[model samples]
Every structure is written in C-alpha cells, then in structure tokens.
Target: MANPVQFLSQVRDQAAKITWPTRREVVTTTIMVFIMATLAAIFFFLVDIAIRTGLTWLLGSVS
Candidate 1:
C-alpha cells in the first residue's frame, strides 16, 4: 500500500488544479440544456402522435 500522508498530499495538489466554471457560464449552460430537452420532448411527442394516428387509421380501414 502507498503512504497515507503522501497520498493525501497528492490529492490536495490535484484538487487545487481544478478550474470551476464562472456563474454566468453555469447559468447559460443550464438554460441551454433545459431548452434542448424541451425541444426534444416536443419533437418526440409529435412523432408519437403521428405514429399512433397512422396505426389507428390503418387498423380501422381493415375492418
């Protein structure tokens, strides 16, 4: 096993190197994610409706 003290020192050094995003960047990215997710949900909903309608018509016409 490695030395505990040395391991702790290395962990601290690595942690210090991290560059966190600015508040503005975080807000902008979060907003973009929400917008994209909404668009995707709408698109899928429309596609599902179209498929269901097509299937219903096809099955009904066969009767």
Candidate 2:
C-alpha cells in the first residue's frame, strides 16, 4: 500500500505546476460559450422549421 503522506506530497507538487485561469478569463470564456450555444440553437431551429415547411408542402401537393 502507498503511504498517505507521500501521496499527498505528490499531489501538492503536481498542483503547484498547474496554471489556473483568472476570474476575468473564466467569465469571458463562459460568456463566449453561451453566445455560441445560443447561435447554434437558433440556427438549428431555423433549419428544422424549413424542413417541416418543405415536407408539409410536398405532402399537401401530393394529396
């Protein structure tokens, strides 16, 4: 079994090497992700409406 103290020391050493993002950077990234997601949702909604309208017209013409 591994020693607990040795494992904790290794964890601490690895943590020290990490470069964490600042609060500003985190907020900016989050906003950009949300904006992109919203745009994608709108684009897919338009596509779905177009497909539905086209199918409706095709079926109506055949009937």
Candidate 3:
C-alpha cells in the first residue's frame, strides 16, 4: 500500500489540475436552463389544455 503522505500529496496534485468554470459561464448556463425549462412547461401546459378541450367536446356531444 502507498504511504499516507504520498497519497495525500498525489490527491492534492490531482485536485489542482481541475479547471472550474468561470462565474460568467455559470450564470449564462443557469439562465439558459431556466429559459428551456419555462419553455417546456409552457408547451406541456398548452398540449394538456388542447387535449382536455378536445375530450370535453367529444364527450359533451355524445351525451
């Protein structure tokens, strides 16, 4: 097994290699996600309304 000190040093080295995203990138991506989610919700809402309307009309006519 490797020595604890050596392992910790290796871990530190690997951690330093990571490149985190910039603040601007994070903000832009967050905004895009919210916009896409809103669009999806709106689309589903419209589709649900249309289906409900159609079914109501069909059932109403048969009664």
**Candidate that scores best on lDDT:** 3
* Lowest lDDT block of 10, candidate 3: 1-10
lDDT of each: 0.98, 0.98, 0.99
Tens digits of per-residue lDDT for model 2, 1-63: 669999999999999999999999999999999999999999999999999999999999999
Candidate 2 wrong stretches, greater than 4 Å: none
Residue 49 of model 1: what lDDT?
100
User: Candidate 3 — which residues are off by over 4 angstroms?
Assistant: none
CA RMSD per model (angstroms): 0.8, 1.3, 1.4
The residue pairs that clash in candidate 2, if any, are none
Tell me the TM-score of each prediction against the true structure.
Answer: 0.94, 0.85, 0.83
For residues 1-63, what per-residue lDDT tens digits would candidate 1 score against the true structure?
669999999999999999999999999999999999999999999999999999999999999
Error of 3 at 42 (Å): 0.7
Query: What's the number of clashes in each of the models?
Result: 0, 0, 0
Model 1 misses residue 62 by how many Å? 0.6
